[model samples]
Structure formats: C-alpha cells, structure tokens
Target: MMKVMVMVKATAGSEAGVMPTNELMEAMGSFNEELVKAGIMESGDGLKPSNEGYRVRFSGSKRSVIQGPFVETNELVAGYWVWNVSSMEEALEWVKKCPNPMFEDSDIEIRPFYSMEDFADVDTSGEFRAQEDALRHTLSLQKASLNNYLFFSGRCEEALNYYVQHVGAKIDLLMRFSDSPEPIPEDMLAAGFEDKVMHCEFTLGGAKVFASDGCNDGTTLSGFSLALTVATAQDAQRVFAALSENGQVTMPLAETFWSPLYGQVTDQFGMAWMVMLPAT
Candidate 1:
C-alpha cells in the first residue's frame, strides 16, 4: 500500500568504474526476479558513473551549470528501485536480502514516497488531486493495444476447439447465432450452420484475437498471417507440427538466415501462420 524508493549509494570502487562480477550480477538478477514475482517491484535501473553527468543550479533570476565527477562520491546514487511494500518493515526486510551492489562496501537507503493523502492539508480545494487524477487517466489512455479478427466460412466452433487443444488458446467469450436477441436472417446461415459461432474472443500467446463464423458466403481468411513467436527452436517445431497437421506447409521448419527455426503453414481451417523462434 506504500511506495518506497530504494537507492544504492555509489561506492569509491563503483565511481572508479569497477564492474560487478558475473556471480554478483547473477545474484542481483535472481533477487530482482524474486521481487518482480512477488509483485512489489515497480521499476529500477543502474546509473552510469557520475563523471558523465552534469548538474544545474538555479537562483532567483540566474542559473549555473556544473559538470560532474562531483567530489562527494558517497553522495552520488549508483542505482535505484521504486517498490511498493505493505510497510517500512517489509521494505527493510527485502532490502536486507539484497546482495552487495558494488565491489566494495555500499549503502542502500529506503525512503517512502509522498502519497496524495499527505497533501490533504495543503490542497484544501482538492485542485491538485483532481489534476493528478486527470494525468493518471491520460497515462492509462496512452497505453496502446491491438487485436486480430479471424473469420471462418462456417467452422468457427471447431476451429476454436482446435486452437484451444493444439495451441492452448483460452476462449474468453463465445456467442452462437441462436443466442442473438434479433433473429439471424435465414440466408445468413447455411442449413445446419445456425448453431455455429457468431462471435468469440480468445487469447493466444498473450494476445487477444477474435473469431467468428461469418455468413456462409464461401469467403475465407487471406492476405495476412498470424506471427507466432516462441522462445526456442523446440517450441517452434512443436507448434509448427501441431498447426500444420493435415495442412500445407509453405516453408518447412528449418534453420533460416533470420531465425534458428522458422516456417510458414496454412492450417486446416485455411488460416496462415508464421511460426518461428525470435531472432537473437
């Protein structure tokens, strides 16, 4: 419920460009991973040596600039993390578990961030709080999103099940022609296609995609292929096999100039997919 900034103080050795050893780096990576898995880590980063930085000082109507290699080495921050913890005690406990961040002895300081509630006495009109809320809303709106929609001639239900079984897609929503409050035109569906899927949403590879059985006009998916990127060659081969079964493989899975494993396949439902491991 409380946000805290944890700062790693720069050490003489760190300021002298002494880098962390592989073992220490691994330990820090593991520690950060643990923090993320616990959902307390908001953001963190290590800073470059202060010698490469600058400072700006301002007076009533004057400004002065100072280049760094700032003499007070101990006062410089080497890195910092913004974490949300239940209490200062929790933050202290987590900090105690962190590895020494520098080659030499170093200090880590934890300070709580000022919450909106702390300003209640100053902002009697609630103006600052309203502005903060509006900025937060704008930040949320700036998050981008994209979704893919697929149409099947009349096999959407079967295709959804096929995807769920083969590629682990999770169907979040589904509606049939009969589920519509307004009657579906007779010509819109072939004889037994009335029970087919009208619309459904599913997630594959962490992306939401839409699927539906459109009017039986014989149209099929074309022009675009869903790109399924996996982590390793083994996964790429396995998914390619599952998707290409009974379908044609435009490009057999093999080592490519771009990827370690790559291929193209048109699934049995006539949907094309590009299966590959991400290029290093």
Candidate 2:
C-alpha cells in the first residue's frame, strides 16, 4: 500500500508570539518515541524556523532568490510524518493516538501518496496490484460508514421492531436491558422501568440507526425526526399506518407532487417519523 503523510499546521493563538517552549519540545520528543515504538510511524521531525529558509525561483533562465521569513506565516506547514500503513483508515487509527503537538488547537491534514504503479496500464499484474486492490477496498468500506446517532427511551427494544417492520431496517446488533452482566441494584432496576433496550442497531438502505433504552430515569426524544423514503405509495401508506397505530399522526398521509404519499408522526416514545413514497 501507499504511504500516509500527516501534515501539521501550527498557529499562534495570542499576539505574543509563535514559539515552542522547552517543555513543549520535551513532550514532543516523548511522543515521537512512542510513535516510533508503535511501528506505524516511519519517520518524523520538526521544521526549521521560516527565517532560516529560502525559496529558489526560475523565470525562463532568469533565476531569482526569495529569502526567508515570509510574512505569511499562517500558510506554513509546521511539521509532518510519513507512516507506512496498509490503508488510510489504518493511518487514521494511529493518528487518533498521536500526541497533541500544540499547546493550543492546531489542524492536522492526512493524505495518502500515490504509488508509481497507479498510473500503469491495466495489463499490469503482480503483488503490487493485489496490494492496491486491497487498499482500495478498505477505503471504500470506510467511506460507507453510517456514523449514525443513537437514541433511546423506555421500551426501546419494543420500539425497534416497529421501526424495522415499517422501515425495512434490519437490526445489526442488540443488547437487551436484561442482558447486563452485572445485576442492577433492585432500587435502580425497579425505579420506574419495566424493560429497557440497552442497545440496538438497524440498517436501512445504506444507512444505520442505533438506539437503546430502559434506564431508571425515563428518557424522551425531542426536536429530532427520522425521514424515510420508500419506493411506492402503497408501501409508504402501509408503513406509515403501522407506525401511526402505536403513535400519533401529526400530518395525515396524502398525495403530493414531491411524492405519491407523505406523512409525519410521533411514535409512543416521542420520536418523530417522516415517510415519503415515490410518485406513481
């Protein structure tokens, strides 16, 4: 796989100055040692001050020299590292543990380098192609991540079935309230809940939804809604009616130019649902 390059941009927070203190330098050295031992990092180093740098320019045989200490310090890259990893995702996993380079907030940009074979003809066949294909697949899977937000209230497990039936979302994982390894204290367990859904995940189309419930203190969903689009008016109406049976309808299902059927409702737990079906 190609190498991953992590570029760090430094900035001066206060007008006082942009200089690394001795303590900060020591911290960076320790952090770099950790990275080296992890085996993911190949090499890294700090840059010389802009004042010690020079730029060479060529204007059609009229070579010119632009000296150091450019006024535009904000545009400069402070430091960088080259990491040998199988994929960008692997590189990101390593980056998450990277030591904070700045005493204040700074931006880090991660990019993958292209190998020479990426430009080669399709007829090329070798271990290089295999590695490239694997990297591409890994990146594709990372891009497909849903990054869904999870919510829950009492009886979330029961609610999950309703959503799955109407939305065609299958539960990928579930942790029921009763499945906790440690026994919940009697007072806490019997506070006010009958049953809770510890955690549950559902996938509809290419998206994911996660939820849980059954805490002693009741939870309620507010100011949020899930929007769903179906393929046909019949499907939409069927799904909406099912969801509405145990919930309250805010907008009656009806035909519209945008979709053959559309409606909104708040399920029994206070979670809002919106349904849309393609126009016939």
Candidate 3:
C-alpha cells in the first residue's frame, strides 16, 4: 500500500475564524463518510487559524520563534487526510470525487509519504533507512514548484517596469531581440521591431514568471489570468490598488468567501491579474 497526504487549503472565511456552514459541513461529512467506507481514509482533521500557531526558525545551531500570522498561506496546511492508496493516480481519482471543500475556488494537494522500502535500492540493507530518514529530517524544507508565463507586445519593457515598481517583481534575466544568436526575421526587421524584448524572466514575491515580446503586436489576450498570492490583508489591498492604476478593475479588492483580500484587474498592458492574500 502507498500512503499519501491530501492537504486542503484554508480560505478567507476559515481564517477569520468563521465556521463552515451547516450545508458545507454536511457535504464534507458525507464525503468523509464515503472515504471511510472505502477504507481509504486513514485519518483527517481541520486546523485552527495560523494566528493560533507558532513557527520556529533555525539559524545554524540556534532556533528562534517567529510567532503566528505567518505568511505564505498557499504553503500553510489547513486540513489533511492520510490515505492508503495503491498509487498516486488512485489517490487523485479519490480526490476528484470529493465535494468542493470550500464555497469558492480552492485547491487540494497530494504528496506521497516516504517509506523504508524507498531506500532498498540504495544499499539493499533496509536497516539504515531509519537512521538516514532521521538525519535527513534536519535539513529538509518545502520549495517553490510552480510559475506563470506571459507573452506581450512591444511594450513588454514598460510592463516589466510597472510590475517591478508596483508589484515588487524582480527581473532576473532579460534578452533583447538583438541579443539573440539567430538574426531577427527579415519581416520583423523590416517592421522596425529589432529593438523589442526577446525574452525575460522575473519573480513576483519569489514566484517565477516568464515574459516575452511576441512580434511586437498589440496584445489581445483571454482565457488565462495571473494570480498573485500575498501575505497579509494590508499587503493584498495595497498591491491590488497599485496594480489598478490606469487599468480596469474586474473585481474590487475585498474580503471574499475564499481569501482575506481578493480582486481581479486588467492592467494597462491588457493582462488580467488576480491579486489576493492566500486563502486564509
């Protein structure tokens, strides 16, 4: 049997210490019942708000308290279930059948648990698994694994500046059309677009983002939006407001069913954005 953890995300309502509605509770209870009947759910429970928790930071041989109200809600554990499944694919199938855990858009992440068998190939002597596992625990931490990409027009440089100054985006790598090893297409060169941005990579609050100037044509976009997760209500509102300048507000920043501060906007560069404080 394979063991996996299915983690539920916290939302704005849950963070403010709001209890789930009876309907939501009933739905979740029914879902949990199904999992139990299938013998797939080993254990599960929700958690109190982050404010009720505390964190410890390590600096070499010393440790310090960071207190509650931690940032990175996306990285926080709201609720979780330990399941005995045959494979990752099987766990996902079960997750899909679960009720919507929240009243709004939410996410559930699954991760496999380490087992002694995992080390069998390393030495064929399973006795060392326990020691290695314990020693490795002192040096491991979660990491960033997702990013967004954007394709823009000739104004990519301007858009990059706007994000840098307003939303705290840091440019990591940028290459202009002239910097490319390949010559600019004859058609584009004749169109006076040789100076356009060719490619750029940046980080918004440590999340990777990619952008490029696609032929320098005016942007016409749809079907996807960039989501920014902030740490606090104050930062959410502040950043949302800053991004709204000279842009259209699709949704005004406000406390929503899912997030502490949530809103959507289409910036001057014609890109849609979802600025939010991580749910809960």
Could you tell me which 10 consecutive residues in candidate 1 have the lowest summed lDDT? 138-147
Question: What TM-score goes with each of the models?
Answer: 0.59, 0.38, 0.45
Q: Is candidate 1 or candidate 2 better by lDDT?
A: 1
RMSD of 2: 20.2
- Which is the winner by TM-score between candidate 1 and candidate 3? 1
- Against the unseen true structure, what C-alpha lDDT does each candidate score? 0.82, 0.68, 0.76
- TM-score for candidate 3, please give it: 0.45
Candidate 3 residue-wise lDDT, 152-206, digit = tens: 7667788899999999999998988878765665776426567777768898876
Model 2, CA-based lDDT: 0.68
TM-score result, candidate 2: 0.38
Taking the candidates one at a time, how many backbone clashes does each contain? 0, 1, 1
Q: Write the per-residue lDDT of candidate 2 for residues 56-161, one digit (tens) a residue.
A: 9988989888887666656766789998887888888767776777778777789888774665675365667767665764554343322343455565666678
Q: Comparing candidate 2 with candidate 3, which one achieves the higher TM-score?
A: 3
lDDT of 3 at 72: 73
lDDT of 1: 0.82
